[model samples]
Target: MLLHILARGRIARSPEGELLDRYLKRVTWAVKHTELPDRGGNIPPLPAQARTVLLDERGKQFSSEEFAAMLGRWRDDGVREARFVIGAADGHGDVARGEADVLIAFGAMTWPHLMARAMLAEQLWRATAILSGHPYHRAG
Candidate 1:
């Protein structure tokens, strides 16, 4: 399955962007990264057989193993793409949240959008690695 990240705002040449790139590079699965303007911008239409995951403060927090399991299930079920949406500074609205297949949160604490993108990238790598029985993720 394709792992796509659709995040608001340009990461530019910041350290966060480098970090995000580093982790994404380690992912064996197909990956895509798209950036939208912080404000108004067109969001690409979702492809058929794709699942949308919205990163929101009120979303559920999953363990690394659980997340890997979910992704494996989706891949096994023939999901073509798993798109993860990260909203702007204010986050996503109710309508978008309602349309999402899943809502996930890093934690209750707020994180900068750039950092969130980097964090998400790392998690994606970790999840994929876990799924492949890689030793990178050490779970108790």
Candidate 2:
């Protein structure tokens, strides 16, 4: 399955962007990164087998193993793509959250959207690695 990140705001040339790129490079699965303006922009059309995961403050926090398992399950179930959405400054609205197939949180603490975007990329790489039985992910 493809791993796609549809986030708001341009990452630009920065440490966070570099970090995101570094992790993303390690993932074996197909992936994509889409950045939209902070305010308004058109979202890409979702494929029929797509799964939408919204990154929200109120979203559920899962362990690395659990996340990997979820991805594995989706792939096994023939999910073509898993699109992860990171919202703007004010975060995702009620409607968007309600429509998401899954809601995930990095932590309870608030983080800048750009930072969150990078972190999400790293986590996706980690999850995929874990699913492939890589030693990179050391469960606590």
Structural similarity to truth (TM-score) of each candidate: 0.98, 0.98
List candidate 2 segments past 4 Å from native: none
Residue pairs with clashing backbones, model 1: none
Estimate every model's Cα lDDT from 0 to 1.
0.96, 0.92
Residue-level lDDT tens digits of model 1 in 22-135: 999999999999999999999998889999999999999999998999999999999999999999999999999999999999999999999999999999999999999899
lDDT of 2 by residue, 1-140 (tens): 89999989899999999988998888899999999998889999999998999999999999988898999999999999999999999999999999999999999999988899889889998999898888988888
Worst 10 residues of 2 by lDDT: 131-140
Best by TM-score: 1
Candidate 1 stretches greater than 4 Å from native? none
Q: What is the lDDT of residue 7 in candidate 1?
A: 97
Candidate 2 backbone clash number: 0
* lDDT at 121, model 2: 86
